[model samples]
Target: MALLDRLRTREATVGIIGLGYVGLPLAVAAAKAGYSVIGFDVDASKVERLYARESYIEAVSPDDLAQTDHLCAWTVDFEQIATCDVVVICVPTPLNQHREPDLSFVEDTARQIAAHVTPETLVVLESTTWPGTTEEVLKPILAQSGHALGRDIFVGFSPEREDPGNATYRTQTIPKIIAGDGEAAQALMEAFYGAVVETVVTVPTPTVAEAVKITENIFRSVNIALVNELKLIYDEMGIDVWEVIDGAATKPFGYMPFYPGPGLGGHCIPIDPFYLTWRARKFDVPTRFIELAGEINTNMPAHIVHRTREVLDRAQGRGLNGAKLLLVGVAYKKNVSDMRESPAMRLMQLFEEAGAEVSFIDPHVPQIPQMREYGIFEGRAALDPGRISDAGFDAVVIATDHDAVDYAALLELGCPIIDTRNAMAKRGLPMDLVTKA
Candidate 1:
């Protein structure tokens, strides 16, 4: 009741862990809602940028950061967790080498909160993870805080619904799904999130909320796989899958359009399905459809490479063994800088393995930062746009279609191109040298 009182009065200190795409926006929204916000991240650079009133994520602007100057604080210190009334974990929940759900970031964050948390503080996990992780994983760890679970320490799960680079929806606009361990936890979570977001949809348990998040992504993965497979089939049959989908879209009943791409990229759709697959195995249930979709999506990059090789051979009479390629976009999605699992990295790896040289140019990604899975190309910079004409590329592969790119310039080179996202055709560019992969 006291925690709810602080939340309703805007006197609560909201601590957000992992100030990336999800955390920063939520932190800003909560601060705007009149709560004192403390953003915690191990990346000191992010903290520095936040303190400088600069935002790295496109969703949060510099003006938004400036507006929160009075209420928002950024820090790399977990010791500051002791002073907060509410702690929300928004860290990455990526998969390990074997494609198993890796909760190391969430676990480490929970440990830090457990070490410094005070009595009667509310804690919630906003990171996407397997069902039951709140009660099974987070509560046991937070129990070490020397406080009662439901009485002194409240734990809950509120899955993040962050759509990077989306102009229409934001953290405060997207309907939030939340669940708590106890009745008190549920009420506190509702009071906290209801103040920050436009709507709060509470489920009976944390596991259901967890499923809600993963189900949203799994639906996307399956739909994307269906379209990708259609792309392959239509490509072989000399039909444009994009055209078919476009025509089908006009009917507007019993059909939704999901376009084909080079591969599944971004943090959610490509990774969240596996979390369910791994968890389902424990129950002796097999998610064959999900696993099949994963397999289909996983092979998309290779299919693009094969098409590039075909273009190289047809135009220049050479294989990919010694081709030079300029990848158009490397960001996981268009118009966004976040590339947690961009398939472009895998394409780079595959191109090099086939003896081809890969250089990428993305308006969103100026320099390839060090990634957890793809570290070999760390610190690699994007190609200079001015040099594209005389860059001597065998084929240009458009992986992501950011609007800022000059697709027309590549046409002047008279070089063959592999168009994955149908960016060229969509722009009314001639298909003389363009091959849709």
Candidate 2:
């Protein structure tokens, strides 16, 4: 009841850890809801940018930063978190080298919170992780502070649904799913997010909330894999998979269109499903659908490379060896600068191995940032239509079809084009020049 009163009165200071894509918008939303927010991140540069009223993430604009200037403060000091009445953990949960769930970031954040958390302060984890993480992992860690869970300090799990470039859904509009360790914790979390977002969905337990997020991603991964497999099967039969999908869309009742691209990208779709697969192994249960979808999706980049080589060979009567190619849209998706798990990296490696020189053009990403798995490709070519038309390349692969790229101009380049995204077809390009891969 006291927590409810503080939240209702907007006297609660909300602490948001990890000011990346998810945390930044959440902080903005919380501040807009009239709560004083303290944005925390380990990266000093990010903290500096926030303090300077700058937004590094494309989803968070300068206007958002300016609007929340008085309401929010940015800092790297973990000790300051003790002053927050509600602390939300929005850290990254990436997979390790062996594709195992790496909970180091979450664990480190939990330990830090335990060190500074006060009694009756609500802690909610918004990172996408496996079930039992809130109870089995976070609860035990917070207990080390000698504060009883749901009694002295409250805990909850709420998965973040942060779509980077989707203008249709913002942090406040997207329905928030929340679950807590106890009734008190659940009621407090419901009121907290309810004050900020348009809708707050409460589940029975934290495990159920975790499973809900994983289920959504797994559904997308499986359907996308199905379509990708269909693309391969139809390609051999000289049928256009995109046309088939269009025809199937006429049904409109039971069909949800999941487009096939070079491969899956972004933070959630590719990685979150596997978190469940790894957890299922603990009980000796087989997650065949998840494993099979991962297998097919992972192989798509190589398939795209093979198709590109075939199209170039048939057009110019030469192999991929020593051929010059241009890749359009290196970012994982359209209209965003996020490059996590992008298939373009795999395609670049394969093109290099095949003795082909690959250059890329992305309006959103001016310079390729350093990635953990892939080496940074120095120098980005301008996306000028005139420059692309004059550049003599053996083939051009549309890896990512951003809305900014001129598809019509790309068709006039007078080279074999492998349209992996089917953007050329959608733009009414002549079928002779554009080969849908």
Best TM-score among the predictions, by candidate number: 1
**Per-residue accuracy of model 2 over 1-437 as CA lDDT, tens digit each:** 78778998899999999999899999999999999999999999998888888888988888998998999999999999889999999999999999999999999999999999988799999999998899889999999878888788999999999898999999999999999889999888988999999999999999999999999999999999999999999988999899899899889699988889999998898999999999999999999999999999999999999998888778888888999899998889988989888998889889999999887788888777777677646454445555776678788999998998887777777888898988887877787788888
Candidate 1 weakest lDDT stretch, 10 residues: 387-396
Model 2 segments more than 4 A misplaced? 378-386
Question: What TM-score do all the candidates reach, one by one?
Answer: 0.98, 0.97
Clashing pairs in 1: none
lDDT of 1: 0.92
Candidate models: Cα lDDT each: 0.92, 0.90
Q: Which ten residues in a row have the lowest lDDT in candidate 2?
A: 376-385
lDDT of 1 by residue, 235-348 (tens): 889999999999999986898899999889888999999999999999999999999999999999999998888888888899999788999999988898888899988999
